[model samples]
Target: MERDSTAGGAEDLLLEDTVSKLRAGSLHKHELAEAMEVEQEGLVEHQPLEQDDLNFEKWKPKPKPKRTLHEKIDDLKTYLWNAETKEFMGRSGKSWSLILLFYSALYIFLAAMFAGCMCCLMWSISPYAPTYNDRVMPPGMTMFPHVDVAHGFDVAFNASDRSSWRKYAKALEAHLKSYDDGVQDRRNINCEGNTYFMQDDLEESAERKACQFKRSWLGECSGMKDKDFGYSKGKPCILVKMNRILGYLPGQGTPVHVTCGVKKGSTEGLGEVQFFPENIFNLRYYPYYGKLRHVNYSSPLVAVHFPSVPYDTQLHIQCKLNGRGIINDSPTDRFLGSVSFTLQVGA
Candidate 1:
């Protein structure tokens, strides 16, 4: 009985201790709740969503607009063309400039093509310019104006008898004697323009030789020499000589091709346009034209035939030492040395 009573009292004490601890824990939790409530007194969330509102202290920026290809290209173009020149000129101002640019590009492209073609064209195929190994070309240079000089002479002789040869020689002798185109006189009288007439100077003198002719061979200089300018019963060769370079006045026809044979024999049967080339200066600075930069080797012959040609070939060149210093290579030294050669009929 005493033991049962003691057990009951112990159980009561244990229950009281448990109640006290629960009370202490409840009080701590209440203090925490109160602190939280105090902190939220002035702040309020206005969200009306059913779910708990999320913290939105930071905001995301919107994405940049996408650019189109055309728009991007337009912007680039605008930036480029906004220069004062383009803007002031506008479409009209640009028209001429654009045309000039286009033509320039076209001309450059064509020049490249022409240069490429130069190596291939039979007439332009000169083994001399690139392959020659001479400081100055030898004499007797006008032998082969074109390979046709021989063939043309052949055709001429075959067209007539030895009398044609006699006539040609007599005409040649007389031509050599005259001061200037005296043989052209009788030539123009009888063989006037129907077939081929001697130019006015050719018509003016029976005693002078302005040009030469052979009946049969042109490509290979034959009959008169191993080679002739052309082979024709009615062939012609003209000569024009000067002590110095009289500045080139525009001519009427045919492109003048220059060669490098200064020696006398170099121009045997071919037309010898003798000139002691004392190169002239001040031509470049005149500002009227770019520069008098080429040798018009065949102008006299062409002028003899037709009289209204203009602008000779403008050779492209740059200054460089010709084995001598620039001082040694002055305008006087810039001789268009023995620059003469033959070409087939009309070339």
Candidate 2:
């Protein structure tokens, strides 16, 4: 009986403890709710009551109203002309003068620096000799009577097309005009062929021997024989001349000559090519002095004739300078010692 009564009392004590713990948790929640409500009320009172109250508080500012056109014009006028500050374009007269003086001094200093740099560069350069001759080594060769020079020395024309052929003829005439007998007389010397005309120092005459490359050497292609230089007749004339460098000498007596042929494996339309001046750039004309030394210097020319070119077909022609000291083929240089040109004759 005593054990049963003790068990009942323990169970009642456990139930009372649980009920007290639940009541305490409810009181904590109610206190937290009151604290949160008090904090919210305080925040609300601190907020801006009137618009004037916003002067001291941080908040999103109201958007400004759009300005009228007249108001904007008035603002612009005020910016341009402020009589009180005695200013124009937002800058006072004194400020503008100071800025102008600063820029003027800066520009003057920069100009002086540029002039000094140019003077130093010129001092490094030699007037008598070239800075680098790698590109100009063995010199360059040029083919005259160039037509349709869009890329390198390409000539493309329709034979039946009169305008196209006429353009080519005119180009040839203009090129030949420079090689006329009267022009050559003024600038060239009656050089002795088959020998190198070498001049070590500037002579009293101040001239070097310029080879007389007569138009007669060109035969039918010469402007004298055919005014169109063979372009009208579908057979075109090409004149090749080497660019002269100061004190450059080719192999003696061997002579640099042009070797022209249709590209290998090409169509057999290109036939019986003829070269004038015997396909030779004679050694006598070489070792040219500059324009300053030789005032009337003329370069020697070799004329090439395409006797029969198939109509309506393109002919790939290779014209190479064959001689010692001349680079025949270079992958890096496209137009160093030789020149390649395309000829498309259409009917």
Candidate 3:
């Protein structure tokens, strides 16, 4: 059966306006039936479009400002400067804060040089450096300081000690004994039947004898150099330092040997041998600290007795090494103290 939808709806109550229009004969029946078969929901309202609103001008956006090269450079500089400041200031110092760097460096360098010099002064370079090369000791016996072979240095083995003189005395004695053994053979020497060798009594004394300076230390540990044949004005001296420790015999005319111990030491850049005085009282045939020096131990000493003692008379002593020639006429050195003794008379 074909049913009409508006047939059961009340007029002016719930019926659609289309139905009302059809009942009033204003709507056509075929249109109403067609409308009933289709959707009869609420109207789909749409706003009317304005003519101006529909107008579409060409779409365009404003141009942005571009940064200049100089601006970029400025920004980079600021960033770098800030970074550097933060790094350096954190340490409470600046990268260029080493203000006295040059002076500090110089101070360290000089200090090192001074230390090196001191070390050299205290040590030797070699043990057999020829000290008497080209130059010979004077005719008499005398002393020549430890010589540096490469440079022809004739000076003592850096004798810088003045406190204990005798501590090195035994070594001096041993060195002399060795030198004697090396230079001359004491083998097969005939000291025939009960032949007792006697020392010169002139060298005998009841008490120990020592050499001491009157008021000053006798040029102790003097740093001198090898000069003309003798100690003119420029030469090194190995002045003995004496005190109670040294065998100082407080009498007149005591025979004493000042054995200078050649203390051995080494250093860098030097090629020389150094020795101390094993020669006492011209122990060798040379001068000790004066000119035209000669060694005495290997030479002869002529002794004479004087009836009259020279008051505060100064006597100079020197010597030569075992294997060298020297002179006794070196006139530069003089006694370092007051005269308290004289040579014994020889028969």
Best by TM-score: 2
| Model 2 score (lDDT) | 0.78
Q: Relative to the true structure, how large is the alpha-carbon lDDT of every model?
A: 0.33, 0.78, 0.30
Give a tens-digit lDDT track for model 2, residues 255-347: 887888776555466787888868877877767667766666667778888869877777777788878788868889767778878887776
Root-mean-square deviation (CA) per prediction: 23.8, 9.9, 28.9
Ranking by TM-score: 2, 3, 1
Can you give the lDDT of residue 160 in candidate 3?
34
Model 1 score (lDDT): 0.33
lDDT of 1 by residue, 243-293 (tens): 122222211122122322223333233333321121121112111111132
If the candidates were sorted by their lDDT against the true structure, best first, what order would they fall in?
2, 1, 3
Q: Write one digit per residue (lDDT tens) for candidate 3, span 239-317.
A: 2321111111211122233322112222221222122322223221111221111112122222111122222222232
Model 1 CA lDDT for position 172: 37
